[model samples]
Target: MTDLSKRRLKTWIRLLGVTRGAENHLRDYLRRAHGTTLPRFDVMAALWRRRDGVTMSELSRLLLVSNGNATAVVDRLEADGLVRREAEDGDRRRIRVRLTPEGLEAFEIMALGHEAEVDAILSRLSETDLEALRDILSRAGRPE
Candidate 1:
């Protein structure tokens, strides 16, 4: 039992370190290559997925962030003409936000770069290694 616990502890630490390292690298890559922050990129990605738009609260929930954090990023995007907010028909207080055409174009470009950056970071891993890691993660929990 102690041996199993030790092994699991080591595995968890290694997994966490690698995840954090990759995330940090992507964050820096986005900032330097696209002049965008990770939070902004995340918000744009979520909006891109939901073309019809989502309420501000929904966006916050999707991003797993506080409303203030989500709103601040949205505020900046709106000022840049990258996003537009519209009030719901029946409930004026429920503002739905979506990417403008320009925002879509911008996010598409950034997403391509983001993919490339991730690929580069993980290039050392063989296809078999990646597949095995994916399987393990899938078994562990969420599928994201």
Candidate 2:
């Protein structure tokens, strides 16, 4: 009921709207330009960062997704020859998933376009505005 409470509520709604809008735009761009879903791109991006590969558990943890979800994506990527799952040397029950050479090349191509798409989407924000927004968000996201 207080003025401060109303202002905070409005700010929260605006923030959510902006975040969803950006996400939707990126999703559309990826689907239209690359014929890929956001989740697939995210999995590839994570694998690209870790050339040595990661365990299925680790991949799920890294992406904050469920093991089954990560496994499904990995399964598809492996089928496409973009990734390989190898049994761990010491642990037969455990497996590590890594991007294949072809996967790396494919991800590189996608990464370039992804960067450009993001740039285009945020083109309206000036450098100064971006820096300011980043600072504000960083502070807000941190625990008090």
Top of the candidates by TM-score: 2
lDDT of each: 0.94, 0.92
Residue 133 shift from truth in candidate 2, angstroms: 0.9
Worst 10 residues of 2 by lDDT: 135-144
Models 1 onward score TM values of: 0.92, 0.93
Residue-by-residue lDDT tens digits, candidate 1, 25-134: 99999999989999999999999999999999999999999999999999999999999999888788899999999999999999999999989989998999999988
Worst 10 residues of 1 by lDDT: 135-144
Q: Per-residue lDDT for 1-144 in model 2, tens only?
A: 999879978998999998899889889988998888888899999999999999999999999999999999999999999999999997879999999999999889989998998898789999999999999988885555
